[model samples]
Target: MFAVIKTGGKQYKVAKDDVIVIEKLEGEAGEAVSFDSVLMVGEGAETKAGVPFVEGASVAAEVVEQTRGDKILIFKKKRRKNHRRTNGHRQDLTVVKITDILTDGKKAAAKAKKAAPKKEAADGDAEAAPKEAKAEKPKAAKKAPAKKAAAKKATAKKAPAKKAAAKKKED
Candidate 1:
């Protein structure tokens, strides 16, 4: 059976045990990931299509490796302008092996368990010790008044000089 799945703004036609290099996905090697945006599923002459996405249809895969594509050189030039720019880029990619395709809300792999929320303490116990407050370090001492005044005077002197230089350049 073959399935068409959409992920990372692209569609791929995949089948069981197929290895494909796709856009980067956040998962470690050997981690299981499911693609729920199934566009189509086919087996021999029987084919099932989705209006947008197939309801309860998903494709499961195992992350095989995380790698990058080949570097592509980008060059830009403007004739007679003495302007030229060059850049190179390599796209992040993930290699995955398609494990199974499931329909009708069935899951092919076990889902990760969510963390349980912490319980709050009851209000009736007055003897229950309150949560300890975080200790904050003392703030640094302020600069001396004489030093601050000197710094301010230095900046004030430089500001007018900068303005004068800018006006001279414009003229």
Candidate 2:
């Protein structure tokens, strides 16, 4: 059976055991992921489609590896102008192998739950925090250069004179 699955803003026709590269997904290699936005499913002449997306239909896959797509060169220029830009880009991708296609509320394999990390206290650090309230250090204030401040005051003083001169000229 073949299924049409939507992922990474694109649609792909896949079947069991088929491998495909899609946009970067949050999973490591050998981890299983499911695509629930199944658009269509087919077996020989029998076909089923979804209104937007099929309800209770899903495709299960295992992450093969994370990879990058081919690099694309972008060039821009304007005739008679000395403006040109050249750049390149590569898209991040994930490779996955299709494992199962479930329909009618059927589920794939049971997913493994990740264990939470345990917190360990250092020697005497845990006892110190509860016994004493730590005081915050004062941040150092930034100081501006005296030369720049004087220059700014000189400019401010000259601005009124310049405006007066402009008014006299206009009159």
Candidate 3:
């Protein structure tokens, strides 16, 4: 199954066993995270989309690793003004592995109600299944502030490089 989950003001499409890199999330490696803002869910040949988000639908995942991306260089110059600027940046990222997709508890409850009448002539065991699925989900933790130290360091290094390069061009 596959699911669309929203977090950190972004949306990501994920599936079981898939590894995805996203904006940093607060948690140690191997810790579990459940995304309750599931926008959509799908199984073989069928899909269910939510109006904004499906109530009770969720995607469970594990934090795999934390890392940063490659540095990007920014440079600006003005002609005959001796004015120039240079900087570099890198973004922190987190890798996660998708584990499972849980159906909306509300949907399951509604379905069970519809299905109850047909199986009623046999037993009451079917009702128990929905109850177990309705158990509470874990609450999400607050996100940690991203560090800008790398960007500051990169800027400090690049300013000298830019000055040296400009001098070489003039020579």
Candidate 4:
């Protein structure tokens, strides 16, 4: 089944499990959102449309993320007037995934919370190996920066001498 819904001053045809990016909506990730301004609903040849909105029809979605749209650059120029303007804009947006389409004034079901993946209790040694390897990486990374510091000190000494010569030339 599919439905035509109106939101953010626009219209969209959506179905179950469909993901769409729409105008900015209030809510964090994994939050439930509903659209009651359904313009039409259809299954195969049978379809229902409304005068303005379908009565007792709604669309249920889950907020995937709150994000911003792509940047849009606006440039304006008036010939021979020496007036010019350059501006850019990125619209706030939201990504949503459709979960259900309901009619007859039905309310959306509550969303389920995700849980962390379970690790094997029998493999306690597997966890310790990774922690030991991670400890060695930072020690090697720290030694490389000491060489860069010595090179930076040599350049710093030359910079001050060049500035002193420039000062003598001015005098």
lDDT assessment of candidate 3? 0.76
- lDDT digits (tens) for residues 1-171 of candidate 4: 999999999999999999999999998788789999999999999999999999999999999998998899999999999999999999999999999999999999887643212234326568786887899999999999999999999888764444433434553
C-alpha RMSD in Å of predicted model 4 compared with the true structure: 7.1
Instruction: Give Cα distance to truth, residue 61, candidate 1, Å.
Output: 0.3
Q: Of the candidates shown, which would achieve the greatest lDDT relative to the real structure?
A: 4
Model 2 TM? 0.65
Per-model lDDT: 0.84, 0.85, 0.76, 0.90
Clashes of each: 0, 0, 0, 0
TM-score pick, better of 1 and 4:
4
Q: Where does the lowest 10-residue lDDT sum fall in candidate 4?
A: 113-122
Estimate TM-scores for all models.
Answer: 0.64, 0.65, 0.58, 0.67
Tens digit per residue, CA lDDT, model 1, 4-44: 99988999999999999999999877778999999999999
Candidate 1 stretches greater than 4 Å from native: 111-171
lDDT of 4 at 131: 86
Tens digits of per-residue lDDT for model 3, 1-171: 889999878999899899999889987676677788999898889988899898779877778888898899999999999999999999888998887777846321111223346457435677766665564332222222223665667778754444433444553
